[model samples]
Target: MAESQLLCMEDGLMPTAVPESRPQFYYSEQHRAALERLITGGDGAFKSLLKDENGQDFLSAREITAITSSFVKYKTDEENGGASAGQDKRDDAGSLHSTYWPQMSDTEVPPLDIGWPSSGLFKGVTRVAVHTHPPKDNGPHIKEVVRKLIQESSKVVAIVMDLLTDLQILRDLFEASKRGVPIYIVLDEPGAPHFLDMCNRLQVGARDLQNIRTRTVKGIGLNLSVGRIPGNVQSKYMLIDGDKVMFGTYSFSWSSSRMDRNMITVMSGQVVDFYDNDFRELYAISDKLDLFKQFHMTKPQTGTLSRAAVPKRPAAATSRFQVNLGDVTRGDGKVPAHKYHNPKYLLALGQIPGPTEPLQDFFNKMEPPDPETEQELENPTEELENLTPDPSPPEKKKSKKLKLSFKSKRGKKDKKSDEVIEENPANPSDEASKHTLTRDETQDSLKKKNTECMCVIA
Candidate 1:
């Protein structure tokens, strides 16, 4: 089919291509062998990642609450001597369980019961096995279960996922493809680029690509609309050989496997067909060429991909809207004086919050400093030095001169004499500074001053 025909239309929705017969879950000796393979022998890619620090996992939000509340309830019953076991105890916050998690949302919700099979919602998916992080009840690890499912699939494997960065899973899938098992993957449009990049890095050639068929969700994924907003393919599930299925919050990405506390439930029998139909529907809607086209669009080297692997914002791309003409003067683009400060004029706050009249810089500008004060302030150090009093003792005799000896260093041990003169108390800073000079320095300064005094005052 042409790639353009795959684009969802407003009126013409393509009918889903269904299998001739509903897939049958035949439990033969092969099923037991697969179970044995799952338990005993399998590839260790999943195990290799689990030991890394980034692979650490924890309980889901609701699970933590459930465990904590159960502990609290048991403790309360113990304290009441088993009398409060039958009585209801409500937590002060709201529900019977304490709010262990603040603003806690149940992202990994437990499978809800489907009205005991009579409500037309239940499917006989009884061969269920679950694995969570922390490995409860000596159950197999999450990665082990995923590896086993893919390892055991005898015929076809279809996976519809959002993200696929896990290399170990890719290796497992590659090995499965080598076993003549045709793999069909329908990925989300948003995350298609990363998966395509990974495939490039792994050196997957044309033949491998042909065997491992991959497609990305195209325009208006779930609904038709006149707007440009694209649909997000958020479904995460896998169908094994058309007869067994696995569905969960556990993403096919590394972060979901390692850092997250996600869970996957694998089932066999009647329910697999329902999920198989859903997978077929998803596969029918996805397009192979659209995946590559989007990859070229969202990749940096191929194109100008911005953060989040999307195009630059409309304002950022257009120079006209992105121009930052200041409030005082907007270059080239000038606003009429009448438009501003009038009923028609409205100032933008640069998209910042907390704008008010008192906080405006225009109304509260600082006044200019006095010119005389500005000049005086320039020589602040000299003024401060003048203001300080001399620490030396007062004169015993009726003389204004302050006599002081300063030792000077000159080649070994040569003595030097300094000239003295009458000192004015008004010029205390000059005399105070002179007190700090060494012998030779003091002598030179005093001699120069004496010569000047002798020449000018005589």
Candidate 2:
């Protein structure tokens, strides 16, 4: 047999198990309606993490118990008569009540009266309007109010939370900048990076516009240095044209209006001036967020000695001893034993020399003698006699005498003449007589010689 095919399977006979899907927790229609009501109501400040994208409350079991506890507390408070019950609801309900329905302390000033009215002339009727979110059913939206404020105002000063991804609000601010309205924004230091990034993106967009003269857009970082307490600039407000002021828990962001519960109050009066003044003071003190300063660490300045006025001490004892010995040796080494039996040495330290002769007289006294110049100075008459001129003229050299002889041709009678001629070889005329005569003079002399020969021949 094949084991009877009907083997009793213990696990198969247990049960046909169907896997359970993740238990879907959703808000009821009543719960959704209540949340909307709560948001629209004065309890709009209550932050909710229960609501989903489809407007459904996906509260966990623990969250539901927390919500139930809140309802129970609300019922108890209603039975007792709300805030007038004089009971500390925060203490009674613990974290739930404290988070959802925080009790306003007596000392806490309302956001609307942040600025007090100054003592000045009330010229015109001060217009005032209060707006809260989730906004009232009949009134203007908070976003629209902000847009209108930005569009109409000549200048805007604001302090707000992190300017996150809020295109509509950022676009309105950019438009305000394009209109040449000076906008001064002060942000908490932590949110400064995000706010600066948003401003850079806005600037990049503004670059494309033609002839669009943009106004001054300045930002400042608020330094809240409190230990481990997570200090932040929690004050959210705006001052327009120093005349109108809008302030509240509201933020300049889309999530603040659409998701987060906040409030804003628009007021125009002498009171606004006070807020404007406060903003100016705060803005003046706020620091600028420079990336180079934040990241590029700098070394602390070290103190240096001044070269111009350095203190110098007197010479050392050994050097002073050597200097004194040298000074003593420069003069006579013999000690004056008669003046002092113990031979006390006289130190000339710090002593100024007494004024004696003038510099010229001293130089004259020290001048050295010149032997030749002294001799000339002592016998001036002998020098003059040596320099005088001689009276007799010099004699000239004697000239030499030369004898000349003349011989006649054989046809004529021979003649010899003895003549004595005083000749000086050194004289110019005697030197000329030794040279050859001119051709004309030679011919005339020859003719005269021939005539004399003819006479001789005749």
Candidate closest to the true structure, highest lDDT: 1
* Candidate 1 lDDT tens digits, 62-100: 643443332211135457575442344443334564448
Query: Candidate 2: how large is its RMSD?
Result: 34.1
Evaluate model 1: give its lDDT. 0.54
What's the C-alpha lDDT at position 153 in model 2? 70
Tens digits of per-residue lDDT for model 2, 1-458: 01212232344653322223434322133444544444344233222423433344444556544443333111355576666533565557663543453575334321211132333555256788988787786888887888788778764435444443466766766676567555556666566676556656655343222111211123331111111112346767777766677888777776788888877898987676667666655555555553324334342343677769757542322341233334334452223222221123223322212134333454465545434333332345632332222232334212233233333444545664333434232443443664434334544554554434322211
Q: For each candidate in turn, give its C-alpha RMSD to the true structure in angstroms.
A: 30.5, 34.1
What's the lDDT for all of these models? Answer: 0.54, 0.48
For model 2, what is the error of residue 208's alpha carbon versus the real structure, in angstroms, after optimal superposition? 9.7
User: Which is the leading candidate under TM-score?
Assistant: 1
> What's model 2's overall lDDT?
0.48
Q: Pairs clashing in candidate 1?
A: none
Q: Candidate 1: list runs displaced more than 4 Å.
A: 1-125, 218-226, 289-458
